[model samples]
Target chain A: MSEATSELYSWRASIIKKQLMALTGLMMCGFLLVHLAGNLLLLKGSDVFNQFAYLMVNNPIIIGLEWLLLLVFLMHTTIGFRLILENQRARTKAYAVRSTVARGSKFAFISMSVTGPLMMVFIIVHLFDLKFGSEYLVVQSDLEVRDLYRTVVEFYSSEVNVAIYIAAMCATALHVQHGFWSAFQTFGLSHARYNRLVELSSDVFALVILIGFGMIPIYFLLGYS
Target chain B: MRFTLRIWRQAQQETTGRFVDFAVEDIPAEMSLLELLDSINRGLILESADPVAFDHDCREGICGMCSLVINGRPHGPGAGTTTCQLYMRSFADGETIVVEPFRADAFPVVKDLIVDRSAFDRIIAAGGYVTVTTGQTPEANDILVAKENAEEAMDAAACIGCGACVAACKNASAMLFVAAKVSHLSLLPQGQPEKSRRVLTMVREMDQSGFGNCSNEAECEAVCPKEISIGHIARMNRQYLFAMLLSGERS
Candidate 1:
């Protein structure tokens, strides 16, 4: 192969794919933290949450950032699926009976295959449900913004909708639990002294995020409509 | 100990392979797993049946030639122990043991229990060595490597090329093996000159050989006979990223 073409072929290397996955995954994790912080305003009631949502959508800078986030999400999901498909192709014949005995959590390890596609589908449905669900997204006279707070509450108030939200949140927790520390490992941040700390902090972050978003559905489920 | 065996049987790479059942009686528990296979092959020879073909050399375990997936775990159940080091005593009497070759598209079954692992050789040939002049022997103190780096390099150098990591990986990824090769040499002063180009060529070769991407499941570390850590893989990632970005290749 020519030098230029070989350099081009290097981009298809498995390590490159893994690096892209880690980079995009960490970026999405950052977005998750910010999104969770904003969602917490749901606990402060409708006006505060609606106005926060309004600012997020209407402000030009925030809108630009939102577009950037969409691009990040697109990259993450695309690379994620590519890795999954490539991995599946690598192992053409499945073992008749297999067992994975490893140091890491098995659920977290295997859940990547499950949670990745689940989260992608959920993100799509979620975007539609919140961002463009209804034509009645006009600014309310009192709140002076779109009633996103009411949209969230209405979405979560249904038993079926709340159930789906909770299930998706669990998947998100599992995905983050594995991906968080793993992203650091991919970036060569794994030190003997800090490995355990990274794992512990990742677990804590996953749980906190899970409960933070999960509570919104519980709040509306408990006759708070 | 008497055990029923379900061993994969194939004539060649072109033919489909399947598990065939055999009963072995009056076997001693003190025999190593490979020795047990030897006895099974001995039985087949006496019966005029085709014997099982597996790979092994320097059965004391340093050669990394022994490759077997015993009861679905690569190199058997013992952590950091190769199949040659695994003994029959570890199994219960009358236990059913299923044995097969490592399953991966990159590893084609050469016979019953042997798969062609020359893919690893090709990957190594792609860029596992440093280019240097060989003439007069240089003084031992010519290049002073840090103690920590030396130790780390030694750790990475322990990889046996057994292909266990590939077998253990759910994705059949060889990142651990390739990382070991890359990190060991790159840790030293002698290997520095070719560091960037070496990593690029080796990694590209690995992908071309049809190995899968690592998902950081760490099954490779768990099953490695040398106990080679997945940290090597992380280090390789760092090296590869630094090389790619520094080389100005972004896609």
Candidate 2:
């Protein structure tokens, strides 16, 4: 009540943690959108897809953005885990039998706790197969540039890898389904008329990201590679 | 009407409690839940038994003093109505009703159907008031306010500080109560000065009181006697974030 000594610092830290979560969530959602758009280029054939990948890694501006991307992911994940742990600690005892009478989006609320850690593992495996793993690489065009297009196609050509990729994309979709609009709400960007539009747009965005990335694995699995 | 009641009874704050069953017969259908309890208490007194010690004041439903979780629903089955407003007719004849005190780590059971909700009072005390000069009242129109803003502020102001939201929440979070208080003040012209500091201080008290974080469960809004929306929680989150993240200033 007095804005006492120890409590003030904890309050500041809690609010700061929530803000960081929203900021990093927005950044990661943006990254997912751009990543989806670029991945869609794979359908246009190997030349265009490889060229896009080549430019993404070679361009100084885009390369700098990757570092920023890493920073955002690091902050988002670290703070997310901290908030989850703190929230868990806040409730001293669990109800003998708990039931939610509120008309909550139960799927969205419960799945976030699952998809977040799943996405973390998915990102690591995804980077290894496409970015760092050299076993799947193919040399192309006399310039000897690594053919990232072949790397993606060959990686997905295995049924096991394709299954893993699809599973990860599903987790991403579920995470964004809740995270997209939640980030906006956390920032206080709500109105009676406009919030409905935001919710609709978030659903569409989640679907597009999932389906767009979903096609590549299906394409390679279907012998189109 | 005759009904069976299973009520939670605790010996003290340090001991465990359990449900004690009683058959309450010959009750009128129009009797309010509190009246039904009163009838049961009179019967117990005649038998030289310890009567239930639930809290109540101004049983007409405005005081927010009545706290009961009837049939596992806070404030009974009705939406936007308190326990005192709930009548015996809401339940069928010869039915069993289970009543318990609002549960939360911060709200310990004081006795049968009573909890120490002083936690809410502490949260309100943190920053629920505006600092004003000691002088004559200002003219009503001295500070122009938008009509819509006034209405919204009044809506948030309808909260009775009842612990239904805390009881309804799965994690026993008090976000709705805090949001109502925060937005009620922050929406008005007089509340602008301490807007940033108010949110920062109140939320800190909420966390320190050992209440859980809001998972957007929305049970609070569902069971609220005033039907306060979770939208206020969003507004509180926004204000708290903006104050700490962008301004980077204490006040």
Candidate 3:
């Protein structure tokens, strides 16, 4: 395509991507909160957590929900890849001298050009380890409830795995930190006090998830398991 | 105080542009940025070189004509102020300043520090105005616009068509400019009849003019001489989407 046609195409694609990312990211955020609540059952004890996991695994309703989650994950990844590729292509021409006006959240958003794909890889690895690995309880015919907890513990016991998980959590945290406020801004949700509150909540939620997910691996590494 | 001014000079739209440097000495600190340019112009004339060409009428910031990118900022560093109002005191003595006309593929250079922003005028001509017949003046209170809406209309109307937002933008997007015109008229009851067409035509013109798409960076709001809110851009987007979906179907 010619530059003009290509430019117009990319502009439309960007608008579509913006809407898709916001919708998917918001949905995933809701899922994360619920997932966190469910996982907190581990704090109660192994039986409670395992029973919860078992119930989820055995229920046909949840099986349907799992399919929906997979669909959402696929859509999110596809849109993310398109966005990243377009951004890279847009900036392929190197600037002889960078303009001084480059500042603030604009730079942050451009840097997301790098962080977004990293987060995608992290998510895939995350799903593979927890959902499809040998430790996955749903795949084992004679799986005991306690075996689920042991599998999680054993997965984190390896130093290399622990390190990888922590890095992934950090990338996820940064992605959420920038993406949350940006989605709000894009949707025209700007009231100063409310936006500040949203920003605070985003930061707090990101920190909590990072620490929450990071702690699991550290727990095993430090012999808590 | 002495300062080096790196000013862009170009004779025509098709010609290549480059920055040329000149030094001015013993300049008063309180002189407005425009006045500083005037001083340089005077110096150029005395030295028998071509006087630096720039556009300005109302030197008092209200007229948006005096647009410049000063030290990489639209209308210098002062927030919510135009180039004509930006005083030389904002800069330190011996500071090197770079001045350039608004750079955009849509806004081609006409001369040094002056661009043909006629693209804006064309976009406005696309359908920026309300369709009222010329006759006796209507009573102000005849149309009962809610006070908030009236205020918003006035705020949007404050956009001076300065083109600073375009110059300040990374992609040279004209969303802020187009939004101002669209929102200004759209806010009032008198402007409602042609509102749908106004947004559609203006946005189409904006895109056709080779302006880039808005990424919601808010840089336009940051550099706008009128301090027009990015909220207008959102309103414009909403209106455009509605117009595209509803109005286009009827047509």
Candidate 4:
């Protein structure tokens, strides 16, 4: 009974679980956009970057928002992993030789389960690399704040850092390619013809995540810092 | 055509099953897969050997009675065709065709190439019908359905309640089947009276039947004999969402 029937039993419970997953996933996607914008400030020099980072870390509302974002992240991952396990359990007896002729982004479609854990591991490693990494303090606006800009630049300066980031962003991009439009589909908003608009936007946003986050490590690796 | 057919064989509902190969010969290209099975069964009967048991009623494509996983693709090869309609020419002349029962917890194998699909019957029984009855035949024009809605309804109505969608789905999910059932009815005015109740209870039964959640992979749509689209699934989600939101109304 490790698999919660509530997760797969009732239509109400199942719908709510997927709804929560879509909501939390969209919230985190929004956070990724905001985080990308914040990190891009590193190009503006340590002073401006530290000033913004310091303000962000010190603001009570921002602290609360960060905690809420963590909660959302946890919810998305937990529901996703459980559903993956439950789905696999759905067919205990396997086909001796199974194949699918269904087309249209099947790699991204099936890769969600794989990318779910990849993103989790990447996020944990990413947090440890910067958020809880060695803190360097510098005077910004007549106050000592954590020099997150220097930390970021120094961390991404390594070729290893850049490589891991590129791979992580690729995985995220693959996941997002499906996850973005899938969130809308989960909410019952889809069109046979016009869903292409949402599907295209999903692809575009995935590219944005890849390029926006991916540029940082490569930018620093190119010795821009 | 000559071929080796590895057909699954099980004596009873509780018994274990395994593939038993038969080297079938002198099959005409025009013979349907089910007819080929008939020929093989006759040979087995003449030899006093146990014949392979499979489900097949109407040899035509529409009945949804024929079920087989020929070489992993349900209903054999070719798109939008059922096993009853699949001809021997679709396969290589001497290829080994592997046939197995549909695998899912909800669909236990009753015999060779016949998984019990009563779960679908139960899901339909739950809420797939309209409550109001007309004693006499009514004029079709009285309903006044939009052209597009009628087309979509007809499209969804094409689903034959075959378990091919369930067999072909990696998760063995029945969303496509249930979606088609829910949608064809929900799109019509005659079916409007119990719309909310229909979606809610049918989905509840589906969940209880031990079918997996839809991951939107859509192999169900691909392998469906009728080529039922997953768009109905999205519509089902929409209906289910509103049904849950408006549950207390008992519509």
Best by DockQ: 1
Q: In model 4, what is the error at residue A170, expressed in angstroms? A: 1.9
lDDT (Cα, tens digit) per residue for candidate 4, span A1-225 = 122343223533455567778889899889989988998888788888889988898899999999999899988998888777777877988988777777535472446788889989999998999999989988776898898888898888888888988999999988888788877877878787788898889999999999998887888889877
Candidate 2 or 4, higher lDDT? Answer: 4
- Give a tens-digit lDDT track for model 2, residues B1-251: 98999888888888888888889888888999998889889988999998988989998778999998888788988789999999999999999888888888889888888899999999889889998878898887998888988988899999999889988886678889999999999999899998888888788888778776665657899999999988898899888877665555554
lDDT of 3 by residue, B124-217 (tens): 9988988886899988788798998989999999999999888876657787898899989999988999888887667666766767645556
Candidate 1 contains a number of clashing pairs equal to: 0
TM-scores for all candidates: the values are 0.95, 0.86, 0.79, 0.93
Give me the displacement of residue B133 in model 2, in angstroms: 3.7
Pick the lDDT winner.
1
> Among all windows of ten consecutive residues in candidate 3 chain A, which has the lowest summed lDDT?
A1-10
Deviating ranges (above 4 Å) for candidate 1: A1-5, A105-109, A135-143, B247-251
**Interface quality of candidate 3 as DockQ:** 0.17
Supply candidate 3's per-residue lDDT for B85. Answer: 89
lDDT of 1 by residue, B34-87 (tens): 888898899899999999999999998789899989998999998878999999
- The residue-by-residue lDDT of candidate 2 on A48-159, one tens digit each, is 7877887788999999999999999998898777667666665554444344676444353455667899999999888988898754344557554567877777788899
Error of 2 at A44 (Å): 2.8
Find the candidate with the highest TM-score and give its number: 1
CA-lDDT, candidates in order: 0.86, 0.81, 0.73, 0.84
Q: Which regions of candidate 3 fall more than 4 Å away from where they truly are?
A: A1-17, A38-111, A128-171, A189-200, B9-19, B42-53, B101-104, B108-112, B241-250
Q: Specify the poorest-scoring 10-residue window by lDDT in model 2 chain A.
A: A1-10
Model 1, span A1-225: residue lDDT tens: 112244534556677777778888988898899999998888888767777887787789988888888888888888787888888888999887677877655464446988989999999999899888753455555555677777777777789998999999999999999899889888878789999999999899899889999987898889675
Every model: iRMSD: 4.1, 3.8, 5.5, 4.0
Tens-place lDDT digits, model 4, residues B1-251:
89998888989878887778889888899998888888898989999987788898888898888888889899988899999988999999999999898888789988777889999999899889986665988776876999999999999999998899989888788889999999999999888988888887788778778887776767888899998888898898888888877655442
Q: What's model 4's TM-score?
A: 0.93
Which of the predicted structures, 2 or 3, would earn the higher TM-score when compared with the native?
2
